[model samples]
Target: MTDEPQRAGRRTRLYALTDGRTAAPHTVLTMDTTITAAVDAHDGLPSEWRAVLAMCPAPNGRAVAEIAARMRMRLTPMALLLGELADRGLIHHRPPLEGAETTNVHLLMRIRDNLARI
Candidate 1:
């Protein structure tokens, strides 16, 4: 049987996961972080990493947030997976233009309070 149904189901799940409101969008996946496939071809990647690698645009690469959105995965877990792939030399992950920043609890709390007000 074709894997079409399985692929479609996966896409559906990704959509559902990404549709909900999240507290720290910036923390998970941000526009500036770029992701590129390090290998020439999909040879020995884990299935999940394969899916992530597939989502990355060739040559130009893709933003981390875009991948997370397409994959319908939470940014935190996605970040971990990406990190693993990068460590394996299967993918390249570039920090955002401004460089990575440590999480500031005060800032997050402020954003959360503001969002709650809306």
Candidate 2:
């Protein structure tokens, strides 16, 4: 997201902490790893990213591009993060509409190009 691999690495670590655990059955902590991770992710989220996610998975569960502008976030990184969230199953990714994927890519590229100028 920041033109560096380390941010992505850190994001992966953050996702591991915040996702994939259920409190059902109320079992004891099998590992302290999860707790630590959650704390880490919660503390590390970029203010912008955190703010974006706070308003995400929109009321209608719209596509990433649709939400990006509203959040004033760059499209490429937001797309990457959406993929990450979906991969983690923290959020659901609806299969694109018949041609939504194509249109989505076009929009993202356009946004990326436009932002590059600034």
Candidate 3:
């Protein structure tokens, strides 16, 4: 009942945000890809875009999955928004390191151990 309207509205908003595009032009982005705000001034940009930029500060960036979770947005659409921003030079993206799964296993193990301590 009430859920119907909310879902419809969310669909409408997502369509508007991505301009009805189901896929991003550049498909290199992955869940672990890092995103950073390239420009400090986002004046005149849409609220959604501004929000995404606000989440990603320079230097230490946020992972694609983290941003999507934080914004309550689906990964595909978030990737679309990020692709548009990157096209406009408003943001920068770095794909995950090659062989991250194999290379970062040690790091992941350490983090897991630390979490178990808490």
- Cα RMSD of all models vs. native, in order, equals 11.7, 12.4, 7.0
Of candidate 2, the 10-residue stretch with the lowest lDDT total is 31-40
lDDT by residue for model 1 (55-101), tens: 66467676665566565667765665565556566777776644244
- lDDT tens readout by residue for model 2, 62-93: 44554455544466545554554444444444
In candidate 1, position 52 carries an lDDT of: 70
- Report lDDT (Cα) of residue 35, candidate 1: 89
| Candidate 3 residue pairs that clash | none
Stretches of candidate 3 off by over 4 Å are: 1-12, 100-118
Candidate order by decreasing lDDT: 3, 1, 2
Report lDDT (CA) for all predictions: 0.56, 0.41, 0.72
Model 2: CA > 4 A from native: 1-59, 99-118
- TM-scores of the candidates are 0.53, 0.37, 0.69
Best candidate (score: lDDT): 3
